[model samples]
Target: MLILTCPYCGVDAEETELAPGGEAHLKRFGPGASDEEFRDYLFARENPKGVHFERWRHAHGCGKWFHAARCTMTLEVFGTYPAQTTKPPKAIREAITAKRPGWTWREFE
Candidate 1:
């Protein structure tokens, strides 16, 4: 299994300790964007053969959200960071927190 180093937890964890959160840095459509544009925005993905950005969760440890650059074929973790790296929207934060045990927020400092 790939060893994931938590920037905050200061521990190298097994791949089972994390969860895949899909593509990262997806931008929300502006009011002026067309419906097709919005649909493409929501449905399209890079699926890069080389390096790709993916969201991950510390399922069994600090229980925080984060992103990682992983190789899809090899499942190698390139890096990881706290979910706050992008300062998630309120709704996103709520959704993540809800999935987490106790539904709490852990500030990444």
Candidate 2:
């Protein structure tokens, strides 16, 4: 069972208790943007086979959203952080690096 710690409430909740919000760190396109850009924003997503970042909501807990770094194939969770961060926190990044060296996600390394 996948378990994630809610950064807001500090509760370790199972995946069944949370709602997935999809890939994290997406670049959103708004009004005045080109049609292609907007279209890509709506449909384009990273479905990597290795380490991936995602958004999760503690639906049955704190009801707050957060970001999590985990391996898709192994389901090994590196860590979780608040959703307000623009990128993965230093500790999370380090943890991932320790496990999967040379790993890079989006612009984070």
Candidate 3:
């Protein structure tokens, strides 16, 4: 089972203990953006078979939303971080790099 540690409550929660909240760190296309941009944001998304970033809520615990880096193929968790920022924290990125070399998600280089 996929276990995630809550940054707020310090609870290591299993997959059922949390709620899947879909993709994380999505760039919002608003205001002056073209129609295609908004449509893509609403309809199109990355559904990779490998490394992916996602949002989750500690439903049975602190009830806080957080980001998690997970491997879709192997179900390996890289790490979890706060969801306030636009990308995964530096440490999480480094951890993923150490385990899975040449892995790149969007602009997180």
Best-matching candidate per lDDT: 2
lDDT tens per residue, model 3, 7-102: 888888989999999999888887999999999889888899989999999999988899999999998988888889688889988898899899
Superposition error at 100 for model 3 (Å): 1.3
Candidate 1 displacement at residue 97 in angstroms:
34
Please list all clashing residue pairs in model 1, or write none if there are none: none
Error of 3 at 48 (Å): 1.0
Which sections of candidate 3 miss by over 4 Å? 31-33
Full candidate order by TM-score, most accurate first: 2, 3, 1
lDDT of 2 at 9: 94
Off by over 4 Å in 2: none
Ranking by lDDT: 2, 3, 1
Q: Estimate each model's TM-score.
A: 0.63, 0.94, 0.90
User: What are the lDDT figures for the candidates, one per model?
Assistant: 0.67, 0.91, 0.89
Clash totals, every prediction? 0, 0, 0
> How does residue 42 of candidate 2 score in lDDT?
88
